[model samples]
Target: MISFHNEGGIMYRFIFLLFLSFQTNAADFVHPYPSFSEGEKLYTFPDFLNAHYYISYDSENKSASIKAEISFKTEEEGYPLFDLKENPTRVELDGKEIETPLVDSPKKETKFRVMNQLTSIGVHTLRVEVPLKFLLRYTDKGVDSAFWLADLDDRSFLENYIPSSFENDSVEMIFDVSFKISADQQIFANGEIERTGDRDFRITFPKEYTSSSVYYHTTPLGSFNERRFEIKSKVSGKVIPVIVYSKTISNFNSYEESIRQTMDELEADYGPYLHSSFIVYDADLSRWGLGGMEYCGATVTNLWAVQHELFHSFFGRGVMAANGNSGWIDEALASWRDGGYFSNQNMRERRALVLDFPYVKKTNRLAYSYGKNFISFLDGNTKMPIEMKLFMKSLYQKKSWTPITTEDLIVELDLFSGNSYQQLFDEYVYGNKSTLDASELWIEPNSSEHSIHRKISGEDLYKIL
Candidate 1:
């Protein structure tokens, strides 16, 4: 993992490129990403249209109550399965109370309960009320945890923390989410906010969203200093609100320019920014571990990490990979774009550094690096004259706010570049039987050239020109 370094009280972001010469065996490492088997049949399910969410929490407490109204259309006279992480206290369909039926002897991979309800072949509405409470725990240093907090300063990660529909599937959802907190506390969400009452704050996502991408955060009113501004796109003249909140007032202004540049460049490269507002939460340096994480229209990170996560608003969370199988696609594309490695030399250098990393089921950092190398090769190498912008723009236009698979992306690649990537996946991405030196991805140094190439181990060489 990359560590945050502070020199002379100034934050310096460093990306670790080299692996240890003597490291633990791969089998000993704890894999971060989970692989689900077919036995876990109760995964994300149910296709819904719109939802109205009302969440109320107290900053001094660890529990919150949520009430949701969901609307869906059934294809036939069959029950639709709803996957919920939390248990529902009450369920009503079409203004009538209904029993919450549970599937018996569900698949072994099912982590949460699945509800199957019979319905007619027409539009139906359901109201669900679920009460959620997270165990409050402190870190090793005795400070409050960011994931679940109720103290002097507070923030709740409501994406998975709150009760919602399936997370992976792509469904058109219009959200009307409101929050009720202390009157003195300030809240920020994905949409426009209105002060409903002295202690109630409501945020409505009027536009259609690809998934249940609703996210909001709250802190004490005066806990942090904030800077609010707006930027208009030259391509579409669409304006977006940008806000940066931080504990210290030193570097929040610098992020405005960085955000504007990133937004403008991405809009020109991909399409438009889909969300209404952008928020950057500069948590304390002690919360560095929580930083660099992305939400729908908000992120919690330092200035440099802002651009990478913001770009995810276009790629990773923006395009919405169908499942964990294709999650690397967006991360790889984001890293490649952030690295600005658009030339053969840049691709070669990146490939040399990341060739040994595992491309399949690797930790997020290594997976991201390996992905960066793979997309860099496809986008920058002269052997494949694929225009990165055109390919991405086409993908964005077609799969915006939708879930996609690796096979689906490969088909698009063949259509655009007239080349098949099945072999590429078999060798690197999906297969792990061969090392970098034995694979065809390595660019061997020329013997006639006077360049110095350092050999790491066996046939592995780090080419230098």
Candidate 2:
């Protein structure tokens, strides 16, 4: 996996692009500075990233021919570092072709590096043709394709199919996508979509999205008997459109009913639903034991994990984990809700969530297990009844679309609870320094056999940011 290495003692003004344009010259999403050495500055990420993908999918051939025009800028000279698991058919730096040999061992991570004199201190563009991969597959009736990503999909995300950056930086992405399938396969995405042709779509995803935020899927007819309906959002008065699909119509009905109740319950708890619409890929997930993965407002889920996955739209995908260490916050929060918010359990296991590196893509596994009880314990320790729930709602309102850290959660909790829980985390969550070990840290391995259509996007797609 190609990731950044941050060195301490770096004091630099990184003009990060927020929801505003680069012309604003604003510094909204600044990279944290423990401090940077003169030598270490070269390894830091770019100031901004805007990627435009032109994709043409051929269903018969089961292939996707893709080209990405990635535009970015930097204040200082640095190398072009992009995490793409698939090798590019061709690479270009400012319209000039460059060789991207396999930088790592074939057994290791797939990586590409841009080497040219032009990679110095200004706006630059990398136009590359990404290689074809499993962006599509044949289901029994038709096909299923998705650019799905999750919290544990370490170093693999938007870059899994196209060229993209890390999750910390909310990159602006545009997709000019088209499909040449049996006229039956349909595209499902969470972005603003404009149909330009019979199967061509121009998708404009939110600029607030990071590497893991996009959820795009293409499923064929007969593979799923889909039912589209509407449900009113409690938080927002908008009548939210919902699409639920499954192999059978009975499953669709059951899922729709469950989704309605679940959405109402979650909205009653959290402030509101965060996405434009909600989509469910209700399937038998007995094969994938990990249950479900949540996208922004969508999920490929079984019936059991409906509430748990949807809760993520308000927390995990909504508030967003700034780094791997903070990733536990949502999982624990969701699992705590799953366990009925019981605040009386004894958290027997002690684990370490504080890792050496902040940007590790994998979260601590205990987040789904012991971490659940820990959050409940925190809630119990709070001053009011279900104070944690109220704090989470406030957090969802404030930090929605923002990336945050474990320390941020601590500070927020301290302010809301009027008590410091740092010592609680230091002892139970962080564990003893003498016995601290990162054995629990791991990435959720990608499984092709079964998945919650993990929260799986498009196009003014030709325009550059």
Q: Write the per-residue lDDT of candidate 1 for residues 212-322, one digit (tens) a residue.
A: 355455545655678999989777888888888876655566788899999998888888887778887765422222225565677656665788879878876677654
lDDT of 2 by residue, 34-77 (tens): 21123333433554468898988776776778898887765556
Top model number, TM-score? 2
- What are the lDDT scores of the predictions, listed in order? 0.53, 0.67
Model 1, position 444, has a per-residue lDDT of 36
Give the clash total for candidate 2.
Answer: 17
193, model 2: CA deviation in Å?
2.3
lDDT of 2: 0.67
Candidate 1, which segments miss by more than 4 Å at Cα? 1-44, 58-63, 76-79, 93-110, 116-122, 135-159, 167-182, 210-212, 285-291, 342-366, 380-383, 432-465
Lowest summed-lDDT stretch of 10 residues in model 2? 456-465
Q: What is the TM-score of each predicted model, taking all chains together?
A: 0.67, 0.81
**lDDT value, residue 272 of candidate 1:** 88
TM-score of 1: 0.67
